[model samples]
Target: MEEMSTILSDLDEIKSALKKSVTKSDLTDIVKSIVKEMLEENKKEMETRVKEIEDVYMRKCGDLQDKIDGLGLEMESLRELNAKKDTAIRNLNATLDDAMRIANEARSRSNYNEQYSRKNNIKIFGLKESNGENVSSEVCKMLKSPAKVELKEEEILAAHRLPSKFTNAPRPVILKVKNTDIKSRVMKQRAQVKSAGIRISHDVTLLNTRLVQRLSNHENVSQVWYYNGSVFAKLVDSDARIKFDITDDVDLKIRKKLRHPST
Candidate 1:
């Protein structure tokens, strides 16, 4: 009975030690469960923060794209406006060119009419003028003596002394003949009359007069004269005669002639 009691006491001691170990293992499992729950909660919070940041970034990108699209539209509108302005400028230039052409045509026609009206007139220079003298009788006497041409009083349609720029010099005379044929005959004897210190020329337009003077002053030209209301130029060392009108480009024509004499 004593031995049996001692064995039972030993078994009781082993039971107490096993119970202590079970209690410690249960505490370790509880700690591990708590740590896992904490980690899950933290992970959820971080994911939420990341999602919010992504939403904000997407909104900013959309706004920037909208602004870029708006700028593109504005730039396209500006390009169209510029194109329209350029077209309008071209149209205005064309209209201005047409107006200038019409103006030039009208001016040319008016000049032609003015030149045609003075066709049958002649001017006499270096003729003596007296205040009360019969101008027609004096003209007849002068033409008969120096020019060797007889003219009836009726052949001269009109005669008058032009205003003199020099007070002491003789005034020039402008005369209208009955016909162009009679005027031609009188012109034929102008060289003979010029030998007696007289000068005769056609009453040409002012533009033609300037052209004649310009041609006379040119080094390339030998003589400039008028015949049948047209101005002509004789080139130096050339028999080629150039007939010029008021509308001609005289300098360009002369240059062309000098470069290509055959033309």
Candidate 2:
């Protein structure tokens, strides 16, 4: 390292000394010492600027810390609110489940006699078919309740049984579904519409899609759908009995048609 005062002294002395047979080595040393001093001065100025920047950053850090603390407080508040809401929802769910169980029991009891009557008279028989083949209701019943049953289109016709095809009419399938996706959507829509105080008719394929979508928006809705322009949906079990004109309230537009009678 070049000594600061020595470099200054060398520069002062070199002018007068250079004219008096100064050695080449002495002039080289003086020039190198002056260059080192200039570099050191530049380094000091950079250090002063760095310190100023550090001070400004330290001030900014205080503001950042305040923002972080505020955000933490807001997060805590939201957590507390969420906890309360969860508790309230749990209580409501429990109450709703109890009510639905009672309603299901009542409905089951009302249908008991009809089911009992059918069970008592259900006959299993075996005989030859009209085309001179061995076929019977008992055989058909056995065929219907086959182990590892995979129903095919032909068997339904040969056995004189109704096909399990979904239709908008008063079909046996009750709910018309083409795939699992549609089934899931329907189940969800059913729960939603029922929760909104809508009565489920015998057939659901007569509902309107837009009305069902509106019911799906409710938190309590479990399913919703519209088939042939009628409204049908299911509600969360807990809220099913809560009466409301859901179809009318949701602004569903439906036109009733005259029933046709034919032989």
Among these predictions, the greatest lDDT belongs to 1
Local distance difference test values of all predictions, in order = 0.85, 0.46
TM for candidate 1 is: 0.66
RMSD of each candidate relative to the true structure: 8.0, 25.0
Query: Which segments of candidate 2 are over 4 A away from where they belong?
Result: 1-18, 99-263
- In Å, residue 192's CA in model 1 sits off its true spot by 1.6
Model 1: lDDT of residue 137? 89
TM-score of each: 0.66, 0.31
Tell me the tens digit of each residue's lDDT in model 1 across 1-263. Answer: 99999999988999988887778679889988899899899999999999999999989999999999999999999999999999999999898988877776776667667767766678999888777988788888888999889977799999889887888878988888888888888889999889989898888877777888888888899988887767899889988999877666778888899888998
| Per-residue C-alpha lDDT of model 2 across residues 87-146, encoded as one tens digit per residue | 999998998998887776665454443333322121112221244433334333332343
Runs of candidate 1 with Cα error greater than 4 angstroms are 1-93
Specify the highest-TM-score model's number. 1
